[model samples]
Target: MSVLSATDVRRNWSQFNDDIVREGPQFVKRNRDEWVAMSTEQLKAAFSNFTFHAHLVQEDDGTITATLDQFDLVENGSSEKEVLEALTYELIEYSQEYMENFKLYFHSPNRKAHFPYILNVVAQDHPENVRQLITCQAGVK
Candidate 1:
């Protein structure tokens, strides 16, 4: 791995972009902070997923628009509590990386209609879980 100062990164952004395109990815530092990485593949994958979500709901702005109609219908349509509990359990069972990606999915600029609903379900009855998620989002350990 390579570390770079923010100034070096800013001063040579084009070079960095070329590196990302030529190589797989490149590490970028900003203000002496290990802020994030630059990767053509990673960005492409993220945006592609976002596009898939947009297509699911016919949104042109590239945001998620997951209406209740998008979810699987219950046999008799249960209460939100039951649905939330089920989803929370699934989230807890999945790896932390999955949950982190989920957070990103929800916070996309082109947010899905049901994105908030999904987050609410995942956060319910799990304050610690929610905090952990926030920590991950803030890039804190």
Candidate 2:
């Protein structure tokens, strides 16, 4: 769904883990020893094959809300880090709808030409059918 931080996985271990208990299979190093999180299916699908972008906002009361640029999805949390973690599930749950935006993106010549290189592509470009994309989240609130 979305890339997660090693801190995100550490802070919420259970949420990052699952029945498939293979180490490092669901993570990619960000820098040093820090890692970015992903689902098994996401891994097989090649997380790097697609680009996904997000927008984070700090609300009036200090809560943070993260929204995917490609989707009409919003996730709230106490911090930017937390919002990012929550974005993992927000993406999967709203995947189908989010993908619809691609249709629009490709339809408009200007939009398609100006599409950011950071947005994730749909399964068509990916071609690999990820059978199990586990939904995960954390205590971002």
Candidate 3:
């Protein structure tokens, strides 16, 4: 991963974009915080390859809404912490169910032939996600 200051990014915006286009991702720092810059293809591949990003939004009704858009999943709570915890449990439950169905269908020769390669691609990019899904499916805490 490449790291650059905020000023460096502003001064060399073209070069930075070029680098991300050729390379992958880069980190830019602004004051105490840092942000990542990646191409759309990179972001799409990351999300489609078993990675997830959760976003929290505050509503006018005094509730916090947490959303993981990749799966079209949403959870609401009174506080940010509550919503996040809910999202975690929801993801685990959903993954377990998905794995259960996948395992059942995988017994078929056609399904077995096609799905494993896709899963293998995801596993190659995000082994942790694959492991977590299988582990969650096993009903392990």
Candidate 4:
């Protein structure tokens, strides 16, 4: 899990996003003291939560906190959005693993039975994003 300050969040949004999917969750510091978290899925939910810091946890009295799962919940729609967000995150994460790094943890025989179909879908949907990520890492156009 990577940690970013509010300023870091603004300056390195894409890298921060890569970290979220590459890792699992990220912490964002506010006012340089308090912390909040956004999940890999939450960042892609960017389409939904256009508000910066929208994923921060809110207390009964509405205070921001560092909790993660709370921030990943989808509002203002049916569960389909949540399902789609989860699928998108999985697509990005596994495509990075399989396409860029050549890692095949998901392809292990024991795991293959459960993950094969999902892996196939990710391969189909995210090859371009995977290519772009690799190109960026390689300093190529």
Candidate 5:
């Protein structure tokens, strides 16, 4: 509710940043445009409750396949570990591409709901961290 003018934010940029770090997100208004400033940690924490739900299948060939419940992304590998790593990499790549084409993706009916999951992936910033969030359930082969 405490929105600061763009000019005031620019004039006290350092203090504004400090305030955000100490007090969480801050809102700023500029000529019909509104923005919220917060640290990466805050952003990550905001989406911490989101998780990647995946279905895992053991192929007859002894390989493993994982398919995410939230997105149309799948990965196959020789082992569960390899599959998880590959899936994490795919997620990071997808999240980056989603942000790169945010407007297009955000407007798409099927993709709009993916925002929180994408943010969760982006916030991790590493494949290992992302891997930790994936919860896999057994799937009938």
Candidate 6:
């Protein structure tokens, strides 16, 4: 609940950073804008509950297809591993695009709910880390 002015934070950047590391997060207000500063670890923990759930199906041709339940994305490959890799790649790209146009995507009604999931994806340092967050289940289709 403690909010510091932007000037104070700028003047004590080192202390501000140290405080965030020790206290978890720090809030700063500048003009009409308010921002929270926290470590990447904190960000990851905040969205850890968010996950990507996918439905998997084996195609008639023997390929495996995965469709994400949370996002409008699908991928197919020769094996489950390959399909998961492809889907994860697509998710990463989508998350990055969503962030690049945050205002547009965040304001949309349907996409608003995607914020936490996008944050979870962004919190990951690598594609493999993101991949581990996804859970897959077999689908009839």
Better of 3 and 4 by lDDT: 3
Superposed Cα deviation of residue 86, candidate 2 (Å): 1.4
Models sorted by lDDT, best on top? 6, 5, 3, 2, 4, 1
lDDT by residue (tens digit), candidate 2, 1-141:
345566666677785676224444455345566454545455435544445556666778989877655445688888865666666655554454435677875676655542322133233233222112222232233
Per-residue lDDT over 70-132 for candidate 6, one digit per residue giving the tens place of the 0 to 100 score: 689999998889999999999999999999999999999989999999999999999999999
Candidate 5 Cα lDDT to native: 0.91
Error of 1 at 119 (Å): 15
Pick by lDDT: which candidate is best?
6
Candidate 3 C-alpha lDDT tens digits along 62-115: 788777644546888888657666776666555455566886656755445434
Candidate 2: which stretches are off by over 4 Å? 1-47, 96-141
Could you report the Cα RMSD, in angstroms, for every candidate shown? Answer: 16.1, 16.6, 17.0, 20.9, 1.4, 1.5
TM for every model, in the order presented, reads: 0.31, 0.37, 0.40, 0.25, 0.94, 0.94
Please list the residue runs of candidate 5 whose C-alpha ends up more than 4 Å from where it truly belongs after superposition. Answer: none
Q: Local error of candidate 6 at 106, Å?
A: 1.0
Clashing pairs in 6: none
Cα-based lDDT for every prediction: 0.42, 0.51, 0.62, 0.42, 0.91, 0.94
For model 1, what is the alpha-carbon lDDT of residue 13? 82
Please give the distance, in angstroms, between residue 73's alpha carbon in candidate 5 and its true position after superposition: 0.4
**Of 3 and 6, which scores higher on TM-score?**
6
TM-score of 5: 0.94
Please give the distance, in angstroms, between residue 94's alpha carbon in candidate 3 and its true position after superposition: 0.4
Model 2's alpha-carbon lDDT is 0.51
Model 4 stretches with alpha carbons more than 4 Å out: 40-141
Any idea how many clashes model 4 has? 0
Residue 43 in candidate 5 has what lDDT? 87
Cα RMSD for predicted model 6: 1.5
